[model samples]
Each structure stands twice: as C-alpha cells, then as structure tokens.
Target: MHNILSVSELSKTYDSRFQALKRINLDIRRGEIFALLGPNGAGKTTLISIICGIVKASEGSVRVDGHDIVADYRAARAMIGLVPQELTTDAFESVWATVSFSRGLFGKPANPAYIEKILRELSLWNKKDSKIITLSGGMKRRLLIAKALSHEPEILFLDEPTAGVDVNLRRDMWQLVRSLQATGVTIILTTHYIDEAEEMADRIGVISKGEIILVDEKAELMRKLGKKQMTLQLQTTLERIPPALAAYQLELASDGNELIYTFDAQGERTGIVALLKELNDADIVFKDLHTTQSSLEDIFVSLVKEEK
Candidate 1:
C-alpha cells in the first residue's frame, strides 16, 4: 500500500522545556483509517498540528503526498483537511454561506453542487439557510466537518471528532467517516475513545510521554498481547485451591462457585487438558465452562500502564 503521509524523526519542544513529541516516525497508508491513541497531553494534537502546519515542529520533517510540509507547504496543505477539536465558526453566517466560503479559502473555485452534497451527506441540508448560532451543538460539530471537507481534500484529519457530542451524533459521525473512506479519502483521527479506534481504525498507534510506543493492526495487536479467561462453574464450594492446581494461574470467583483460569492466547498451548486432568484428580466437578477474550480497552490500558 502507498503511504499518503510520512513523518520522520519528528520532535517538538516548547520554550518552557516541555517536550511535546519525541523522535516519532509514522507512515499513513493511502485510503486507510489510522487512529492515534493516547491520553491527554500525549502529543496527539501536537503531531496533527505539525502535519497540518498549524504548529511548527522543532525538529525532523513531515510530508503529505510527497510534498514536504515546510518546503512545499501549499502543496502539502492543499492535500489535507483538518477538523479541529474546537468548534469555531461564524455565528451569523448561514450554513450554506459558511461552507461555501471555506472552499474559497483553499483557493478552490466555488462549487455549489459540491457544497450541497456535503450538507446532504451530513444531514445538514435542511439547515442550509439557518445561521450557525441557531443550530444545535451537534449541528455545529457537523458544520466544522463540512468546512473541513468543503475544499475536497484527499486526506482528512479528525481531531477528537466525537468529543462532547451526543450518542446519536457520534453514531452519525462514524457513519459519515465510513462514507468518506468509501470515496477513497484517507482518514487519520486522534481520539480518547478506545472503542472508536477498535471499531474504525485500520491500524492503532499508541503514544505516551512524547514517544511512539506501538503501532500495529488491531487484530494482530490483540492476538499478540491478548489473554483469555476460562471460567468454570464449580458443582461444590471449596475452601482453597488444591496443591495439584497450584502450578496454574487461577482465581476463584462468583463466591467460590466459579474458577477462573487465565492464559495467553498467543501461547502454543492453553493447558486445558492438564487443568482438566488435575481437576478430576482433585475431585473437582465443573457443571459449566465459558471463555472470554480480552477486549481492546484492556489491551490499551495494559500498554499504557507498562509504558508509564
């Protein structure tokens, strides 16, 4: 796959001696939704800001579609569109007017048809004549996205696109993102929502303390670090684990009615046969057994904690 955006040895340092970003290197594949995951102040915004030319990097470089952000800033910026976390729009401007004006800002010729399509896609067509202030909070967020797409950018960067939005609007925005992906628009988003990353991202990138800690396909990441738990419903209560089962990592749960055995999914063997044999020897009877895999949220939390 071809990469639309590339960052090499990117670093950012503020005057206050704060290092916002370390030696970061990343490549965003063409037409893939890449999610950057991190806690607050983890340089998610700073990385996007540098790529979009909103904030200058202290070191290293960024290239958008083969155009260096610094040397060929115009060409690079023209290939990208950014929907900021903040909602800053003209209060009195009509929806149509605001969207149309955004297109002109990118040196794009006026295209009423294109503007209309975006509004209709975002379900903002009915409010075309309504002033921005008259619209709801959700509408304002949608309008920001409209303005970002008004210029028909090839690569769209969404910064916490669903933050502070309601459930319905969040679902709507996710649908909108999928629609854009269908049109071959590359999307890179930074979000605190782990499930959003799990559901939408083609690849996940984890950053912490000004460093790029990990990046991999969502499924692969899960498999490599994922653990599974097998829960057994005991037929009778037991005072403690037998010495024969002490070799295995197990926990008693459900008030001693359940026994939980945890093992790595990526391991060569789950040791179920050994555990069953040992249980039989100990006269332990399980009426039911069920298994569960670790979720993305669990993996994310563990990674962050390990990094910290």
Candidate 2:
C-alpha cells in the first residue's frame, strides 16, 4: 500500500527550550491501522497534535495524501478526524445537534441520513436527543467518536481512544474502527494499552525521548525482538546449577526445583536439544517443561527501559 501520510524531519520544541520531538521521518500506509507506542512525555501526543494542525512544528513538514499541512492546511485538515484524549463537548447541546454541528464546521452539507447512521452504529440513537452533560463517561466517549466521524474524514486519529472506557465500549469502538477501515479510512492511534495495539495494529512505531526508535510490521517486529523462555520443573531440588550448564545461562527458580532458559525463537538454532542432553549428562532430570514467548508489552517495556 502507498503512504497516505508523510512526516519528514519533524521536530518540536517548547518556549522553555525543551524539545519534545527530534528530527523524525515516518510514512503511514493508506488504509492501515498504525499504532504509535511510547511512554509518557515521549512525544506521541506532540507528534499527533502537529499532524492534526493543533500545534505548530518547530522544524519539519507533514503531508496528508500529498497535501502539505502548512501550504494546504484546509485540504490536509479536512481529510483527517481526531478523537482527542480529553472528553470535551458542549454540555447543554443535544447529541444530534453537536454531531451535526461538527459536520457543518467542515463545510459539509446537511445529511441527516448519514448522521442517523453513525448514531445507530454507536448505540446512541436512543439518546440522540439527550444533552451531552447527561451522558455517562462511556456514552460521552462514544459521542466524541461520532463527532470525529461526522465529516466522513478519510484519515482518523484516535489518541488514547479507549483509555478510561468499559470493556463493552472498548469492544464496540474497535468494531466500529474495523468497519471504518473497511470503508477505506486510514487509522492512526496512540494507545497506552499494548494489548490493543498487539491485537489490532498492522504496523507498529515506537518512539522514545523525542526520537523514532523503531518502526516495523507487527509480525516481523515480534519475530525479531521477541524472546522465548523454557521452564523445566526439576525432579530434584539443588542449591545451584551445575558448572557444565553455565554456558546455557539458565536461571534456577522455585527454590532450585526449576530451571529457566531464555532463547531467541527466530535464531537459526535455539540450543534446546543440546541443553536437554547436557542436563541429562549432569543428572538433572526435569519432570515437566513449558515454554512462553514474550508479548508485545514485554518488548515495549524493555525498549523504553533501554532508552532510560
């Protein structure tokens, strides 16, 4: 797929002389779910804001479908929709009125049928006449989404979209997101929930300390950085691992009744067979063995920790 959004040499600095983003370059493929992962104060929000035209960049350029964000601000911003982290809305305005107003803001002609479709999809049809202040947190979250989709934007930015919502809302939001993508809407989300990104993202971009640390296809990333651990339940307890097993770098656990071996699953050879044979030679028998691969969360935490 071709890139729908391009960010080149992006950098952001506040008046206090603090830099939030370094010279960054990124391309977001059209109609793909791209997840931007980073720790707090890691420039995820700064980058999103710049793209959405909410904040000015210190030095760089952004383009939406080849429309320069600065030179073609109207066209670039028109194609994008942003669901902000804050739950800001007109308290006294009815849901339908607020969503309809959003569409008008983008110079879109009145389309009641389209408005009703989104309301029903969001399960807000029954509450369409209710005031925003009367809605619960989850309902309010859904309203924010409805407004973002009001203009039928080609690109959507969900910043911590499911942060404080319930399980049901989270599930519903993802379902809606999928449907939107099916209709050719490109998705870019910044989320604290690693599991969400792991399950949904087509590609993952990790940023750290104002720098783009890594960006890769999700499956390729997991294969390259992911580790696997094999745990062996010993037949007998021991005070320490045998000298002969030192090369394997096994860790003794469960009061020396278990041995943990870490290896790269993608490696040419994992050394599992050699380790098992060596264990037999040392008379260290295992009653049971199981293995687990590191999750995206594990890789994300380790990556951020390394930056620190």
lDDT, candidates in the order shown: 0.92, 0.94
Model 2: colliding residue pairs:
none
Candidate 1 lDDT score at position 10: 100
Give one digit per residue, the lDDT tens place, for model 2 in 65-173.
9999999999999999999988677799999999999999999999999999999999999999999999999989889899999999999999999998888888888
Number of clashing pairs per prediction, in order: 0, 0
Model 2 residue 182 CA deviation in Å = 1.7
C-alpha lDDT (0 to 100) for residue 293 of candidate 2: 93
**lDDT per residue (tens digit) for residues 203-273 in model 1:** 99999988999999988998898898899999999778887898887898858889999988754265888
Give candidate 2's TM-score: 0.96
Per-candidate TM equals 0.96, 0.96
How displaced is residue 73 in candidate 2, in Å?
A: 1.0
Q: Each model's RMSD to truth, in Å?
A: 1.4, 1.4
- Give me the displacement of residue 284 in model 1, in angstroms: 1.7
